[model samples]
Target: MYSLTLEQDNRATVSAAIHSDRLVVACLCAAWCGTCGSYRTSFETLASKHPDMVFLWVDIEDHADIVGDLDVDNFPTLLIQRHDTVAFFGTMLPDPAVADRMIQSIAELPDAELQRQAQSTAERRTWQSECNLRQLLNAPG
Candidate 1:
Protein backbone atom coordinates (compact mmCIF):
# COMPACT_ATOMS: atom_id res chain seq x y z
CA MET A 1 0.00 0.00 0.00
CA TYR A 2 1.21 3.47 -0.83
CA SER A 3 1.10 6.28 1.73
CA LEU A 4 0.64 9.79 0.34
CA THR A 5 2.96 12.54 1.43
CA LEU A 6 1.06 15.70 0.65
CA GLU A 7 2.91 18.33 -1.32
CA GLN A 8 2.18 20.95 -3.93
CA ASP A 9 2.78 18.50 -6.77
CA ASN A 10 0.55 15.84 -5.22
CA ARG A 11 -2.35 17.99 -4.11
CA ALA A 12 -4.61 16.60 -6.78
CA THR A 13 -4.01 13.02 -5.72
CA VAL A 14 -4.50 13.87 -2.07
CA SER A 15 -7.65 15.78 -2.85
CA ALA A 16 -8.98 12.84 -4.82
CA ALA A 17 -8.23 10.49 -1.98
CA ILE A 18 -9.99 12.75 0.49
CA HIS A 19 -13.15 12.62 -1.61
CA SER A 20 -13.32 8.85 -1.39
CA ASP A 21 -15.51 6.89 1.01
CA ARG A 22 -12.61 5.15 2.74
CA LEU A 23 -11.30 6.34 6.08
CA VAL A 24 -8.64 9.03 5.89
CA VAL A 25 -5.72 8.89 8.34
CA ALA A 26 -3.73 12.11 8.28
CA CYS A 27 -0.52 12.88 10.15
CA LEU A 28 -0.19 16.61 10.60
CA CYS A 29 3.46 17.48 10.95
CA ALA A 30 6.01 20.10 9.94
CA ALA A 31 8.92 19.66 7.55
CA TRP A 32 11.51 21.07 9.94
CA CYS A 33 10.51 19.03 12.98
CA GLY A 34 13.03 16.30 13.76
CA THR A 35 10.50 14.21 15.63
CA CYS A 36 8.18 14.35 12.67
CA GLY A 37 11.00 13.24 10.37
CA SER A 38 11.88 10.33 12.62
CA TYR A 39 8.26 9.28 12.91
CA ARG A 40 7.65 9.19 9.16
CA THR A 41 8.86 5.64 8.67
CA SER A 42 6.70 4.31 11.46
CA PHE A 43 3.71 6.15 10.06
CA GLU A 44 4.32 4.66 6.61
CA THR A 45 4.64 1.20 8.10
CA LEU A 46 1.35 1.63 9.85
CA ALA A 47 -0.19 2.71 6.59
CA SER A 48 1.20 -0.38 4.90
CA LYS A 49 -0.62 -2.48 7.46
CA HIS A 50 -3.93 -0.93 6.59
CA PRO A 51 -4.31 -1.15 2.85
CA ASP A 52 -7.96 -0.19 2.82
CA MET A 53 -7.48 3.19 4.47
CA VAL A 54 -6.02 6.33 2.95
CA PHE A 55 -2.93 7.55 4.80
CA LEU A 56 -1.69 11.10 4.32
CA TRP A 57 1.43 12.86 5.56
CA VAL A 58 0.73 16.56 5.63
CA ASP A 59 3.46 19.08 6.41
CA ILE A 60 1.64 21.87 8.15
CA GLU A 61 4.02 24.54 6.98
CA ASP A 62 4.24 23.32 3.40
CA HIS A 63 0.49 23.12 2.93
CA ALA A 64 -0.60 25.91 5.19
CA ASP A 65 -3.58 26.65 3.03
CA ILE A 66 -5.04 23.24 3.78
CA VAL A 67 -4.30 22.98 7.48
CA GLY A 68 -3.40 26.47 8.62
CA ASP A 69 -6.51 26.91 10.73
CA LEU A 70 -5.97 23.59 12.51
CA ASP A 71 -4.64 23.87 16.03
CA VAL A 72 -1.82 21.37 15.84
CA ASP A 73 -0.08 21.97 19.12
CA ASN A 74 2.39 19.15 18.72
CA PHE A 75 4.38 17.21 16.15
CA PRO A 76 2.71 14.17 14.63
CA THR A 77 -0.85 15.17 15.31
CA LEU A 78 -3.42 12.74 13.91
CA LEU A 79 -6.76 13.17 12.22
CA ILE A 80 -9.02 10.31 11.30
CA GLN A 81 -12.20 10.82 9.35
CA ARG A 82 -14.72 8.97 7.21
CA HIS A 83 -17.05 10.81 4.90
CA ASP A 84 -18.43 13.80 6.81
CA THR A 85 -17.58 12.48 10.26
CA VAL A 86 -14.37 13.32 12.01
CA ALA A 87 -13.89 10.20 14.06
CA PHE A 88 -10.76 11.28 15.93
CA PHE A 89 -8.44 14.26 15.96
CA GLY A 90 -5.72 15.01 18.47
CA THR A 91 -2.04 14.79 19.28
CA MET A 92 -0.81 11.24 19.07
CA LEU A 93 2.30 9.63 20.47
CA PRO A 94 5.11 8.83 18.05
CA ASP A 95 4.65 5.14 18.66
CA PRO A 96 3.17 3.33 15.66
CA ALA A 97 1.63 0.66 17.87
CA VAL A 98 -0.44 3.23 19.68
CA ALA A 99 -1.66 4.62 16.38
CA ASP A 100 -2.40 1.16 15.10
CA ARG A 101 -4.44 0.34 18.16
CA MET A 102 -6.31 3.61 18.04
CA ILE A 103 -7.14 3.07 14.36
CA GLN A 104 -8.33 -0.44 15.04
CA SER A 105 -10.52 0.61 17.92
CA ILE A 106 -12.04 3.48 16.04
CA ALA A 107 -12.57 1.47 12.88
CA GLU A 108 -14.38 -1.13 14.93
CA LEU A 109 -16.98 1.31 16.14
CA PRO A 110 -20.31 1.22 14.33
CA ASP A 111 -20.88 3.99 11.83
CA ALA A 112 -23.88 5.25 13.76
CA GLU A 113 -21.90 5.54 16.99
CA LEU A 114 -19.03 7.27 15.23
CA GLN A 115 -21.41 9.75 13.66
CA ARG A 116 -22.96 10.38 17.04
CA GLN A 117 -19.62 11.08 18.67
CA ALA A 118 -18.65 13.35 15.80
CA GLN A 119 -21.37 15.68 16.95
CA SER A 120 -21.74 14.74 20.61
CA THR A 121 -19.18 17.25 21.88
CA ALA A 122 -18.11 20.75 20.90
CA GLU A 123 -14.51 19.74 20.38
CA ARG A 124 -15.51 16.90 18.11
CA ARG A 125 -17.91 19.14 16.27
CA THR A 126 -15.04 21.52 15.71
CA TRP A 127 -13.23 18.67 14.02
CA GLN A 128 -16.00 18.47 11.50
CA SER A 129 -15.27 22.06 10.56
CA GLU A 130 -11.50 22.25 10.95
CA CYS A 131 -10.20 18.75 10.50
CA ASN A 132 -12.31 17.51 7.65
CA LEU A 133 -9.78 16.85 4.89
CA ARG A 134 -12.37 17.01 2.15
CA GLN A 135 -13.65 20.35 3.33
CA LEU A 136 -10.14 21.70 3.70
CA LEU A 137 -9.16 20.52 0.25
CA ASN A 138 -12.26 21.94 -1.34
CA ALA A 139 -12.29 25.19 0.60
CA PRO A 140 -11.87 28.39 -1.43
CA GLY A 141 -8.59 30.13 -1.21
Candidate 2:
Protein backbone atom coordinates (compact mmCIF):
# COMPACT_ATOMS: atom_id res chain seq x y z
CA MET A 1 0.00 0.00 0.00
CA TYR A 2 1.23 3.50 -0.88
CA SER A 3 0.28 6.51 1.26
CA LEU A 4 1.00 9.71 -0.65
CA THR A 5 1.42 12.92 1.35
CA LEU A 6 0.53 15.35 -1.36
CA GLU A 7 1.47 19.01 -1.55
CA GLN A 8 1.98 21.59 -4.28
CA ASP A 9 5.57 20.45 -4.58
CA ASN A 10 4.58 16.82 -5.19
CA ARG A 11 2.31 17.08 -8.19
CA ALA A 12 4.63 14.96 -10.27
CA THR A 13 4.53 12.22 -7.61
CA VAL A 14 0.76 12.06 -7.90
CA SER A 15 0.95 11.52 -11.66
CA ALA A 16 3.56 8.78 -11.32
CA ALA A 17 1.59 6.99 -8.58
CA ILE A 18 -1.36 6.28 -10.87
CA HIS A 19 0.54 4.30 -13.46
CA SER A 20 0.69 0.93 -11.73
CA ASP A 21 -0.17 -2.70 -12.36
CA ARG A 22 -2.54 -2.52 -9.41
CA LEU A 23 -5.41 -0.04 -9.46
CA VAL A 24 -4.89 3.54 -8.24
CA VAL A 25 -7.32 5.25 -5.85
CA ALA A 26 -6.75 9.00 -5.65
CA CYS A 27 -8.79 10.93 -3.10
CA LEU A 28 -9.02 14.59 -4.05
CA CYS A 29 -9.68 16.51 -0.87
CA ALA A 30 -9.06 19.83 0.87
CA ALA A 31 -7.52 20.47 4.31
CA TRP A 32 -10.26 22.88 5.39
CA CYS A 33 -13.10 20.59 4.39
CA GLY A 34 -14.78 19.06 7.45
CA THR A 35 -15.88 16.00 5.55
CA CYS A 36 -12.36 15.50 4.21
CA GLY A 37 -10.82 15.89 7.67
CA SER A 38 -13.20 13.41 9.21
CA TYR A 39 -12.83 10.88 6.41
CA ARG A 40 -9.03 10.96 6.26
CA THR A 41 -8.49 8.40 9.01
CA SER A 42 -10.96 5.94 7.55
CA PHE A 43 -9.46 6.48 4.13
CA GLU A 44 -6.01 5.62 5.46
CA THR A 45 -7.36 2.52 7.15
CA LEU A 46 -8.97 1.44 3.88
CA ALA A 47 -5.71 2.01 2.05
CA SER A 48 -3.88 -0.35 4.39
CA LYS A 49 -6.12 -3.22 3.35
CA HIS A 50 -5.49 -2.72 -0.35
CA PRO A 51 -1.76 -3.29 -0.27
CA ASP A 52 -1.43 -4.00 -3.96
CA MET A 53 -3.07 -0.77 -5.07
CA VAL A 54 -1.77 2.80 -4.80
CA PHE A 55 -3.74 5.14 -2.54
CA LEU A 56 -3.20 8.90 -2.69
CA TRP A 57 -4.63 11.89 -0.84
CA VAL A 58 -4.43 15.04 -2.92
CA ASP A 59 -5.46 18.42 -1.49
CA ILE A 60 -7.37 20.29 -4.17
CA GLU A 61 -6.02 23.69 -3.20
CA ASP A 62 -2.41 22.59 -3.47
CA HIS A 63 -2.72 20.65 -6.71
CA ALA A 64 -5.87 21.88 -8.40
CA ASP A 65 -4.13 22.36 -11.72
CA ILE A 66 -2.83 18.79 -11.77
CA VAL A 67 -6.25 17.38 -11.03
CA GLY A 68 -8.04 20.02 -13.10
CA ASP A 69 -8.74 17.46 -15.82
CA LEU A 70 -10.97 15.75 -13.27
CA ASP A 71 -14.18 17.70 -12.61
CA VAL A 72 -13.82 17.60 -8.84
CA ASP A 73 -16.56 20.05 -7.91
CA ASN A 74 -16.95 18.36 -4.51
CA PHE A 75 -14.57 17.50 -1.72
CA PRO A 76 -13.60 13.92 -0.72
CA THR A 77 -13.73 12.92 -4.36
CA LEU A 78 -12.34 9.55 -5.48
CA LEU A 79 -10.63 8.89 -8.80
CA ILE A 80 -10.07 5.23 -9.60
CA GLN A 81 -7.49 4.47 -12.28
CA ARG A 82 -6.31 1.23 -13.81
CA HIS A 83 -3.49 1.17 -16.36
CA ASP A 84 -3.28 4.99 -16.28
CA THR A 85 -6.90 5.47 -17.36
CA VAL A 86 -9.80 6.46 -15.15
CA ALA A 87 -12.11 3.63 -14.19
CA PHE A 88 -14.36 5.54 -11.78
CA PHE A 89 -14.75 9.09 -10.46
CA GLY A 90 -17.06 10.18 -7.65
CA THR A 91 -17.28 12.26 -4.46
CA MET A 92 -18.36 9.63 -1.98
CA LEU A 93 -17.15 9.73 1.62
CA PRO A 94 -14.85 7.05 3.03
CA ASP A 95 -16.44 3.71 3.80
CA PRO A 96 -14.23 0.70 4.44
CA ALA A 97 -16.91 -1.72 3.24
CA VAL A 98 -17.32 0.12 -0.05
CA ALA A 99 -13.58 0.44 -0.38
CA ASP A 100 -13.14 -3.27 0.16
CA ARG A 101 -15.74 -4.05 -2.45
CA MET A 102 -14.16 -1.82 -5.06
CA ILE A 103 -10.59 -2.95 -4.36
CA GLN A 104 -11.63 -6.57 -4.50
CA SER A 105 -13.38 -6.07 -7.82
CA ILE A 106 -10.44 -4.25 -9.33
CA ALA A 107 -7.87 -6.69 -8.03
CA GLU A 108 -9.70 -9.62 -9.58
CA LEU A 109 -9.93 -8.02 -12.99
CA PRO A 110 -7.29 -8.47 -15.70
CA ASP A 111 -6.11 -5.51 -17.77
CA ALA A 112 -7.96 -6.55 -20.88
CA GLU A 113 -11.21 -7.17 -19.00
CA LEU A 114 -11.02 -3.88 -17.14
CA GLN A 115 -10.31 -1.94 -20.32
CA ARG A 116 -13.28 -3.59 -22.05
CA GLN A 117 -15.57 -2.75 -19.13
CA ALA A 118 -14.38 0.86 -19.03
CA GLN A 119 -14.99 1.23 -22.74
CA SER A 120 -18.43 -0.33 -22.41
CA THR A 121 -19.34 2.00 -19.55
CA ALA A 122 -18.19 5.05 -21.54
CA GLU A 123 -20.22 3.97 -24.53
CA ARG A 124 -23.32 3.53 -22.38
CA ARG A 125 -22.94 6.97 -20.85
CA THR A 126 -22.48 8.58 -24.28
CA TRP A 127 -25.53 6.75 -25.63
CA GLN A 128 -27.67 7.79 -22.68
CA SER A 129 -26.67 11.44 -23.01
CA GLU A 130 -27.32 11.40 -26.75
CA CYS A 131 -30.73 9.81 -26.20
CA ASN A 132 -31.66 12.51 -23.69
CA LEU A 133 -30.53 15.27 -26.04
CA ARG A 134 -32.50 13.78 -28.93
CA GLN A 135 -35.59 13.47 -26.78
CA LEU A 136 -35.29 17.11 -25.65
CA LEU A 137 -34.91 18.31 -29.25
CA ASN A 138 -37.93 16.28 -30.43
CA ALA A 139 -40.20 17.55 -27.62
CA PRO A 140 -42.94 20.04 -28.68
CA GLY A 141 -42.03 23.65 -27.98
Model 2: how far residue 102 lies from native, Å? 1.4
- Candidate 2 lDDT, 103-123, residue by residue in tens: 678768887876666668765
Write the residue-wise lDDT of candidate 1 on 1-141 in tens digits. Answer: 757989788888988987887788999998899999999999999999998899999989988998999999998899999887899889999999999999998888889999998999999988888788898988887
Indicate the TM-score of model 1. Answer: 0.96
Q: How accurate is candidate 1 locally (lDDT)?
A: 0.90
- Residue 42 lDDT in model 2? 82
In model 1, which regions exceed 4 Å deviation?
none
- Listed in order, each prediction's TM-score against the native is 0.96, 0.76
Candidate 2 Cα misplacement greater than 4 A, ranges:
123-141
